[model samples]
Target: STYRLLSLVLVEGARVQPHYIADTSRRSTLLELRTMHHIRQAVAALSPEGAARIAPTRIVSVHDIAPAPEITARRNRLTRRAYLGGQYDWLARFAAQFDIPALELCIHVDDKAHAFISEHVEQVEGEYWQLRKELVDTDLSLFRYFRFPVLHLTKLEMDRLARQHGFHEIMQKTWFCHSPWRGRPCGICNPCVYTAEEGMAHRLRPLARLSYTLLPVLSVVREARRFVRRVVKR
Candidate 1:
């Protein structure tokens, strides 16, 4: 039950391009994909047919959708609400491309992140919570298969469930760093910092991870690297 639907999404956008079409021929092959196996395991529970074809999601980027070209573009940062909008747009495109009869968009943002979403509107400068409840309430028709079934669980609890599904070893193999050092988790980015905070990566040091989360300069550099990687195919 614990492993029912935990939310820890660190899938490589490149892997599920439908073009790659995973050759899940053996366990060792799946292990090479690291954390994606956890997702595959979950999808298997929902619909075995969908799980079999994991390579259909390409060009997946998290952002906002604005009327202006600049705001909608990846160059500008999206407001929390716009970010959700962009996600919806992406799914629409995904379904169109893959000819998917239907798709289930599972959103399991962490408790730490959820602490920021609020519909009441924040006049404060430094706020982190605000879900675009108003927008979602209006045009419900846009989301044909968007499902956030596990907002009740925290990142820690969800991750624990992930490991519970006989994926403890593979979970460790999962990569989160956008700018991995020689193809390994930088272990200092925001996600990696959370990973350490939740006691997910024992190999990462306590002080270093905390320091990385606090340093704005390092955050920018890492985010830039991720942005570049997402736009350009290397």
Candidate 2:
């Protein structure tokens, strides 16, 4: 959804200094890379002649860098504080270097569609709109280049926008899995779950769809395990 929005932003005369941040913690796979390429191609196909001015995407790896302890401590409830902090820090520096005034993020407060989900909360809580806004406004305040084009729209709204703009096919090709098992989406992962719940289960493969069907039972088992742990502690 975000990718399609970004592509539209570029098509509508938003100059893009393309960069892809590869976070090791997320375990992005070859499938994602291929889909990304296709998205780029789709964008290029829409560009007017000689207007394919979008730069080649520069892949920036955050595998070796530890998230700053201060940043992590501030957002202890959120699992990817360090990763998010680190990405913003690097982006700020990069923007400064190139004199880029705006960095557009496809964050939708309505759907809490920022990349990171919290370990301490249920999926809905993890995507709590206000909580995500606070994280962006507080911890990620290092740069003034932040611009959110779709901040007020929900995921479903974004889909509607894509479909209205005739990019629904490309939207279907976009990748969302944070973890891939054997080159397929790990159906129980947060991204997969969100995708399914958001009415994009058709995006998942047959095997993933099967796994998604078991999600409710899996949730029950997880809660039972947590309950047993709490009882043991008591």
Candidate 3:
């Protein structure tokens, strides 16, 4: 979605970065690199006129582990809040060093951002959940150089935009798995679930699709567990 959004804009060149979780499988990372390589090759194969329309892009790696040790002090355990904070911190430094005017973040709009935060506040875990009791705000407006280009669009909306802009093929090359099994996406992961729920199951492998088929049953089991936990707490 972010890539598709960038394709519509006028930019000299693009530097793609992929963030990695220390403990999870590196399948997504590998896929990202491959996809970028494929894209560059496709661009190179294009006619000069066609290639000129697309921005030259390259992959750049940054220090992704423990960008915020205070919150992600536990080894291989980084919360979403801390992860994002770390990313913003790095972008701030990068922008200052290069004298860049502004930085655009391709984060899509989460309709349930507030709801998710509220629901997970009492829970022990969640990537996007707040680790501190006093901080309930989920807004990422503190970064002055950060601009959210797709802040108003949902994942489904982004899909529509991609199709409308003829970048759906490029978008299809994107990877979204956090925990992959044998180089394939684990369909039960948040990204897989969202992809299935957002009407993109055709992209998932057959086994992942099978797992997605059982998602309703799994959802029921989760709700039951949550209900029992709430009852026991009361």
Candidate 4:
């Protein structure tokens, strides 16, 4: 399945341009194609296991040249759609062209942002539950428009799923790796700090621990940088 999917991508590249094809003898995975210079290098890195699975093929570099203002505007709109959960259609189209099944690997759960805020707010203030409820409703609405099969799992549930998918040990070890502190999770931010703490408190899964460790620090740094830039602009 992986080989066929890659072949189709390569074929698409051929249709786009003839000279785009480069030998991919070293590349291990399709992700290496993201870098133009690494195309051949990545193809060279492919393991025997990967080679036996897929055919050795030349890859093409699909470069986007600067266009006129109207073309740029259209490209921006298309890019936005591609980012905001609209890439599924693109994938479907690609799959149809290659006669392959377009499988969606969905990871659905509660919004970490709301969950984190709820934990920090005073329970007596009644804002925590209200915000949490709103997030739940928002997530429900978001899922209604999702066309793929979504595996709705809590932080803990996701761990179980990861283990089932043969990444149990990796998931467990990486959980705490993202923490701001060595042993304790940061109790702020949406994904890393907040989700980490909650998952740990509830023994959600070892896989989810790292986000608590690392994400808060990164988010804080980014927010601070943004604030500084805004103040400078003012």
Tell me, by lDDT, which candidate is best: 2
Give the top-scoring candidate (TM-score): 2
Put down candidate 3 lDDT per residue, 17-61, tens digits, no spaces: 322223223446766566656655554453334345555442334
Better of 3 and 4 by lDDT: 3
Q: Tens digit of lDDT per residue, candidate 1, span 1-234?
A: 113222222221112332122324322333335445565676667555545545533332223212333223421232344434343444544444455542333333443423323223222233122234554433332443233344355556666766655544434445455444544556666556666666565645555555565667777888999999988975
Candidate 4 — which residues are off by over 4 angstroms?
1-99, 110-152, 158-221, 231-234
Q: Supply every candidate's count of residue pairs whose N, Cα or C atoms clash at under 3 angstroms.
A: 11, 0, 0, 23
Error of 3 at 61 (Å): 4.5
Choose 1 or 2, whichever is better by lDDT: 2
Model 4: worst 10 consecutive residues (lDDT sum): 11-20
Look at candidate 2 and tell me the lDDT of residue 158.
Answer: 71
Predicted structure 3, TM vs. truth: 0.56
Off by over 4 Å in 2: 1-11, 25-27, 46-51, 64-67, 77-101, 113-145, 222-234
TM-score of 4: 0.30
